[model samples]
Target: MFLSKLALAVMVWTLAACSETSGWNNVIDSHEPKQGESTPSKDNSDTTLASEPVSVGGAFLVCAADDSFEMEAFGCRLEDVTGEKLNSTDIKDGDLVVSNGTQAYSAVAIEGSESFWHWYIAAPLADVSLYTVQYVGQIADILNVETEVQIQHPEKQVSEVTMESPYDDRHLMFVTSIAYQAGQVQNGFNSLASADALCNQHALANGLPTSFKVILSTSTVAAAERIRILYPVYNLEGNLISNPNQFWTNRHLAAVVADKMPSSSEEEEDVTLFEVWTGTSNSGLVKGTETCADWTDNTANEKGNFGMASDARKWVDDGGSRTCESRLRLYCLSQ
Candidate 1:
C-alpha cells in the first residue's frame, strides 16, 4: 500500500503537538522549545496539540491482537522494560561499523548488571521494540550533527495499512539543517536510549507488532579519534536490525562510511537533540539518562502485525534521509 505523504505529515504534526516535546522533523523540523525530558539538550513548554488526527471510518483504532512474549517471563526487568519511555545511548567511540549476524550486543546493561536477560537479548528482533541510530550524512541530510541519529522502525507482519504525506507534487524530501559540532572523540559513546521507545511506538501506533532498531555509540578511553562501524550487509536491515551470528563482533561484510562528517564550522550546529516522527503519545523524550536498550528482547514479533504490499522504495524517493538512522541504500540488494 502506498502511504500518503501529506496525510502522514498532518498526522505526525498533530501527534507532535499533542506530545508537546519531541523533535518531529518528518512533520515539524524544530525541536520543542521547552525541555520536558532529559537533555543531552534543552527545551520549550508552549507547544500544544495543533489539531486532531483525522480518523477514517471512525475516530478510534480497533486493533487485532497477537499471541506473543510476556515480560512476566523476565520478572523485574519486565516492568523496567514496559515503564520505559525512551532510549538514548552515547556513542563514546566509533561511527561506521557493520553488524555481524549475532546481535550487536550492548556492553553495559541498564541499571548496572553483568548481562541482559535472554528476553532482553531479543532487541534487534523484538516486537513492540525501540531502536535508535546515530545518523550522519549518507545520501542527503541537510541537518548537521555528529555521531548520533535517533530513529524509529515499524513493521506489521500481517496487516495492510496506508500512510500518506502532504507534499502535493513534491515527491522529494528536502533536508536542510544548519551545521553543527561533533567534537573529535576522545572516548566511545553509546547510542540514544529514548530513541528506542519512540521507534517502537511508531510501529504500535500503526497497529503492527512493534520492534525498534537504531545505531548507538560505545566509548573506549582510547578507541579512536573518529568512531566508525560496518555491519555485514546480510546482518543489517534498512533499519539497524542486524543478525547476531553473522555480524556480531565482526566488521568484515559490514557496509560503512568514514570521514563523512561536519567540519568544525558546521559542527557549530551541534545540538545533542532529537529530530523525530512525533505521535499522539506523551512527549517523545522519555528520560535523559535512561535508555531502553536495558530492556529484554522477545523472540516473537511481539508488537504488531504485517503485510507484503507496502513500498519502502517510495519512502526514500520521497525525500527520506539517505541515512537518517543507519539505513544503507547505496549497496546492491541481495538477489
Candidate 2:
C-alpha cells in the first residue's frame, strides 16, 4: 500500500523506536508483545524496559520475536560492546553464530546509511526456544552467549497480526551510495572483503541492513557463489528484485539505491545507469581474467569488468570492461 511521505516517515520512525535499539541502527526484534513481556515506550517513560540494549564484550542481544508472515522466528541484533555502531569493518556473518538450540541460522547483515548499523540473524522460533549468539571471534575474542527460554506465539497470517516492520525480516538488496575506482578498492588490495566493508558502511550509515557482500567476481570465485542465501531479494523500496533461485536469471522490478529515505527525487534515483564494477558476466561467472588483476591493479595497463547500473539484458554485466583506474560504484547484496 502506498503511504504518504509524512505517514511513511512516522511509521518508519515508530518501527525504529519499537523494534530496534535506541541510538543504534541494529534491529533485534519485530515480534509483537506477549503477555508478561514488556514493550519500550516511544517517550522513554516505561521504567520496566532496559534503558539500553544489554550487551557483553563483543555484542549484546535484545530478546524479541519474528515478524515474518510465513514462519515463527526469533532474531537479535549484534552490537559492539563499546556502545559504538558495528559496521562491516567491525563484524561479518562469520563473526558470530545464532542458534535455536539445534541448527544454526546464518547471520544476516542489516545495514543502511539511513537506519541501523549492526549484525543481525534470525532462527526458527520454537514453542519455547533457547537462543544463543556466540561471538566466533573472527574479529574479536570468542564468547559464548545465550538467552533464556523465550516463549513465542503460534504463527499466524499477516491479516491477523500487526507488526513493526512486517518485511524487515526478509532478505534485501541495495546499491552503494559511494563509488570507487577498480584499483582504489580496499586501498589497491581489490579484495571483495573490502568491497563488502564499503557496502556495510553505506547500509549502516543509511539505516539499512548491514550484511552486504559485493557482487563482483574474481577469476576463482563466481559472483553467483558469493550470495549465501537464495531467498527472495527486495530493494529498499520493498519491491521485488529477484525471486528465490532466480537472482541471476531474472530482471528486477526496480533499481536499488543507497538512499531509502522518502524523497521527491526517489523516483529519479537510479544507480544502475551509472558504471558499476562487476567482473562477472550476465551469467554471474567471471567474464574474463580482466578483473583489474583481481581488482588490485589500478594502473592504466590493467582493466576490469564493469556493467551499467541499468543493464536489462545482461543483468549486471554489459559485456564491457574498463581500465582499473576508472572510478565506479559496486553492487552490494544482503545475504
Candidate 3:
C-alpha cells in the first residue's frame, strides 16, 4: 500500500516546465548543436550529459536511510511530453546523475516501473542541502533531464529553505481545524481507527487529500512509525512546521498550522489554546499507556495524553494528561 501510494503521488510532480528558468541561475544546455548549427559553449563547471535534454519531474527530499542510517539515496521520476511515467528499462546505469556544487552521484537502482528512480550518494551531505540533478539516458533515443532536489536527514536541522510551497508535494502534517465536542468522543468513536476516520472525513470536506492518519499511538505501535517516508511536513497554511530530523527530536521550526473550521455561529470561534489528543510523547512513542485504554474508554477515570496545539516545544506531549471525556483535536499527517 505504501509503495502504491508513493507511485500515485508521483503524478503530482510540478512539470519540468516549472524548472524552465525559475531559480536555476546556473544553466547548462545539454542538447547538442544541429548539423548546421554551432555548438553552444558553457563554463567548465557545467554538468556534462550524454545527449539533448528531456523533461523530468517529481523531485523532493526523501528520508531513505537503512536500519543503521548509513545509506542515503536521492530520488526522481522521469516523464514524457504527455506526462506519462517512464519505465526503468528506459534508463541505463550511470545515465541519471545528481550533483551538488562539488560532487556527482549516479543512479544505482530503479524501483517499480513508472516509480521513483533512486540515485545512490557515496558520501551524502552531513546537513540538508539542495542538489542539482542531471539525467542523460535513453528513452526512444538518447535524452537528458534536469531538476533540483533536497535530501533531508530525519534527525538533522535544515540550514537552507526553498521558495517552493512546503505543501508542493503530498506530504504534510497538520492539526485538525475542528475539535471534538466532549460527547463526540465516547466509547465506540474513541479508538485509533475512529480518529483516523475523523481526520480523513475532515480533510475531504475541506477539499484536502484524504490520505491523513492521526499521529497517535497505542501500547504496541509507535506514532513515529506511522509515516514511512518523511517528506517536508507542511501545515494547512502552506508553511513548513519542522524539518524531518527535528520532528523526531522534538525540535520544531515553528508551531503547526491548524485547519480553519467553517464558522456557523459566534460560539465556534477559534480557541487561543487548542488541545490535541496525541497519546504519544515528544519522542514519538507511546506515553506510558496513557491512551485511554487504547482509545476505547472515554470515562473520567481514563486519562489520555494531550498536547498544546500552539506550542512547538510541547506539540506532541505536554507532560500532562486529560480526562478521556474532554474535548480535543487530533494531529494528522499524510500517509
Candidate 4:
C-alpha cells in the first residue's frame, strides 16, 4: 500500500504540470550553437566517472548511538533511542558513504529515479558517524537539482541590522524566516520505482546496528523561524497563518506558489522565494516530505488531500511551519 501510495505521488508530481503551459516548461533549442559545445565532444569515449567523496570518521564499531533526545526536541526525529552510542563523524564530502552509528547512516541530497529504498527512509543528522572504510558509488540523478525547490530564498532582498542586540537586554524579540527546500532523491533519472527499490535494498543491507529509543520534544525557541513567514496577506489551505495537523509537503508549498504566485515574468510582482533548512538544530538531519493522490471519487476516501498535508500548513508562526511575518521581525530577508 505504501509503495502504491508513493507511486501515486510520483504520478501526481509528474502531472503537477497538469496545465496548458506545461508544454512550454522544458523546451530546448537544438539549433542554438552549443555555446561551449566541443565539435568532437561526443567522442563517445569510455570515460570513467569519478567517485563521490565519502568521509569515514572512525573504524566500524558494533554499536550504534542515537541522540534521540535532541531529535525529538527539533521535531525531526520522532523516535528516541538511549544507549552507549558508536557513530562516526569527522568526514568530508561524497563516496559510497556508510555511517558509523548503530544503524547505517544515510546522507542523501539529490533526486531522480529512486527505488523503494530511498523513498521510505531519511538520514538522521544528529551525531551521525562517518564510516572507517570508504565507499564508492554514483550520485542520485535528479531534476531542478536545486532550482526545483518549493521554498526558494529571495533572489536579492536582504537587510542588515548592526544595532545593539534587541534581546540582549530584558526586552527583546526573537525573529527569523522559515524556509524549506524540496529534496528529490532520484534513483536513475526519471525512474521513481527504481529509486524506491534501491533505497530499500540499501537500508536493509545497512541495518540499524541496534534498537534504541527515539524521543520527541518542543520549545518556544523552535518557533522563531516559523513566525517570520506567517503574514496577513498569505492564506495557506484557507487557514490563517496558524494551522496544525494539516499535512504539507515541499510540493504543496510549490502548489501554493503555482496557484497564488504571479506569473514568473510578471513585472514588479512579489513572489515568495524559499530555501530548505534541514535539521536546523545543527543535528544534520535533512528535512523533507512527499505526497500523492488516490484519485477516487468516494467521500469515504478523497482522491487525495489535494496537496493538503499536515506539513503543508506552513506560514505558521508556531514552531511547526514557516511564515513571513517572522521575516519582518528578524529583518533578515532571505535571498
Candidate 5:
C-alpha cells in the first residue's frame, strides 16, 4: 500500500517538474561560452568518433573533500589533489565520469588553468570516494582505458559532509519539512505511511534522498522505539537539538536554547507553528489516547499529543488537549 501511494506521488511530482533551482547552476553558467562563440583552442582532439580510440590521461581526484551546505559547486583544485598541473588539453567539459564506485556524474564546467573541474551529479549521491573520467568517441563510444582517482582527503568522514537538505545528510537521521496539519491526505497523509510519503516528496522536490520516515507514534507504538536514531535532532537552521545526554523533550529543548535566545526580530507569525503532532511523550514514549484517532480520523473530537517549537515545556505536552481538527505540523526523519 505504501509503495503504491509513493509511486503515485512520484508520478504527480514528476509531471509538475519538481526540480528545484539550485545555486550550482550559477557557477556552471559563469564559464559557459556565448552562443556561436568558440571556446579556447587546445591541443586535445575534439571528443568526436575517430577511426581509432583516444587515450585520455591525468585522471585524478577532483572533489577530494565532502561538500558543504554553502557549497554552490562540488570540485577541488586539480593541482592540490593530483599534485600535477593541467590545462584544458588534459580534460575538457562535457566529459562523462563515475564516482562512488560506479555512480555516473558529468563534468559541467572547468576553470583556473584546469585548477578546478565542476561536476554535476544527475542524481546526487551521499558520498563519492573516487571519480573516473571516460574518453569517448564522436558517436559517444568508449575509446580508451579509464583512470580512477581517490579522494585526496580520505580522512574526511561522511558526517563532515554538509548537504542542502536533511535527507542528504550522511547519517540519514536528518528530518525534512513538517506537515501543516494532521489529516488523512487524499494521496495518503496523517497516517504513518502517508507521513513517510510526504517526507519523501519533500526530499525528491529538493533533489535529495527520499528514504525518510515520520517521527510519530500510534496508540500502541512509540516513535523512539520504531525509528532508528542516528544523531541528535536538528532544526531548520542546522543547529543541533538532541545531543549527548540530552533527549527530545520540553526540558532539553528549553535548556539548549536558554543561552541562545531567539532574536527579537524573529516574528512568531513567520515561524511555522512547531506544534508538531507527536503521539509520543517527552521521553520518546507514547502517552495517552491522543493519537488523533490512531492518526486516521482528523475530525475526531479527541486530541493528539504534540510538541511546540517555541515552548520547550510544551514540546511534548501543553498540559492541555489540542483538538484533532486543528491543523498541525509533523516531524519527519530519515532512516
Candidate 6:
C-alpha cells in the first residue's frame, strides 16, 4: 500500500543506475558537461533520503495480486517502470515499481490476504513535505484506487496536507523570451497580420512557442479587445509580468500604465519611459486624426499617438504622438 523512506531511496538509486544503461540514458548523457568543463551540482538531490523525486516526465507502474488479470489493466508501463521491457510475469507481490529502470518498492503490499489484491500508482508527489509516496491513480482507469496511499517519511511528520497542482506531462506551460523587431514596419503592415507574423517568427527563432500575437491597436479595434483578457502573463521564471486585473479595462489609461509598469518603480521620483506605438488613448480608443493614414502609409507627415511604458498615467495615452517613420517595440502576448 505504501513504501518506507529507506525503500524509496534504494529504488531511486537502482533506477537511476539502470537508466544510465538504457536508451533513455543517451538523452541524459548528452546533457552531461563536455571534457574540461565542470558538471553542475544536483541541487534537487535528496540530502537525507536515498531516493530522489521522480523526474518530470518519467513513467512508473501499478501492480496487483490477480495473476490471470492483465497487469496492464493495473496501469503500469513496463518499459517506463523497468528498463528491461519485461511483462507482468517479471513482477512479484509487494512491489511498487517505476518504469524508469529502478528496483521495486519492496515495502508496499496489499493489507489483507494474498487473494485480496490492492495496488497504487507511484506518481510523483507535488508536495514532498506531506508525503513521500503520494500516488494519483487516475492516469489509467484500472489503477483508480478508492483512496490515495500517502507514505510519510519517518524523519519528518506531516502536520497538514497542502494540496498543489499535480505534475502532468501534458500540462506544461512556457513563457517566451522578450523579443524586439529588427526594424520598423509600415503601420498597415498587413493590417496587424504582418506584426503577428513577426512575433511568431521571433518566438520560433528563440525556440519558444509560436502562439503569440502583437499587443497593438488599430483605429477600429483596441489592443485590449484583440488579446486575451485577465491573462496571467509570466516571465521565464514564472513571475508575474503584467498586472492581471487591469489588463482588460477599456479606455483606462492609468490602469493600463499601472499594469504595464514595473511594481518596484511605481513610486520612484523619475520613472523610466517605455514609449511604444499605440495609436490609441487611455480609453483604448483611437486617439489622433492621423494614424499613419489609417495605418496604410508609412510616409505620412502626420503623427500617430503612442503611449509611455513606464508612466502609469501616460502608459495608455500620454497625449503624445510619434511620426510614422519612428521605430519602436511592440508588446507581444501568448495566445
What are the clash counts of all predictions, listed in order?
Answer: 130, 25, 3, 81, 5, 11
- For candidate 6, write residues 283-326 as lDDT tens digits: 34455463555555555475766666554445546676777765
The candidate that achieves the highest TM-score relative to the unseen native structure: 3
Give Cα-based local distance difference scores for all models.
0.22, 0.57, 0.59, 0.23, 0.50, 0.41
- Give the TM-score of each candidate: 0.16, 0.45, 0.49, 0.17, 0.41, 0.36
Comparing 3 with 6 on lDDT, the higher-scoring candidate is 3
Q: After superposition on all CA atoms, what RMSD does each candidate show versus the true structure?
A: 30.0, 26.1, 22.9, 30.2, 28.7, 25.8
Output the lDDT of residue 2, model 4.
100
Question: In terms of TM-score, how similar is model 6 to the real structure?
Answer: 0.36
TM-score of model 5 relative to the true fold? Answer: 0.41
> How much RMSD separates candidate 2 from the native structure?
26.1
lDDT of 4 by residue, 1-335 (tens): 99999999999887876753565554532334444343332675544443443332222111112223233111111000111121222222333334343555443322332211111114443332232222332323211111111111111101222223222221111111221111223211112222223223322333411111111012211212231221111222333321111111121121222122222233313223422211212111122211111111112221111111123333221133232111111111110
Displacement of residue 87 (Cα, Å) in model 5 is 58
Model 3 lDDT tens row, 74-150: 44455332223454354556755666677766656554563433344444644223455565554432222354343
Weakest 10 consecutive residues of candidate 6 by summed lDDT = 147-156
State residue 189's C-alpha deviation in candidate 1, in Å: 14
Worst 10 residues of 4 by lDDT: 74-83
Clashing pairs in 3: 54-144, 154-245, 155-245
Q: Which is the better candidate, 1 or 2, if ranked by lDDT?
A: 2
Off by over 4 Å in 6: 1-190, 235-238, 241-243, 249-273
Candidate 3 segments whose C-alpha is farther than 4 A from its true place: 1-170, 181-188, 263-268
TM-score of 4: 0.17
Off by over 4 Å in 5: 1-179, 253-272
Candidates by lDDT, descending order? 3, 2, 5, 6, 4, 1
Error (Å) of candidate 5 at residue 286 is 1.1
Worst 10 residues of 5 by lDDT: 255-264
What's the C-alpha lDDT at position 172 in model 5?
33
In model 2, which range of ten residues has the least summed lDDT? Answer: 148-157
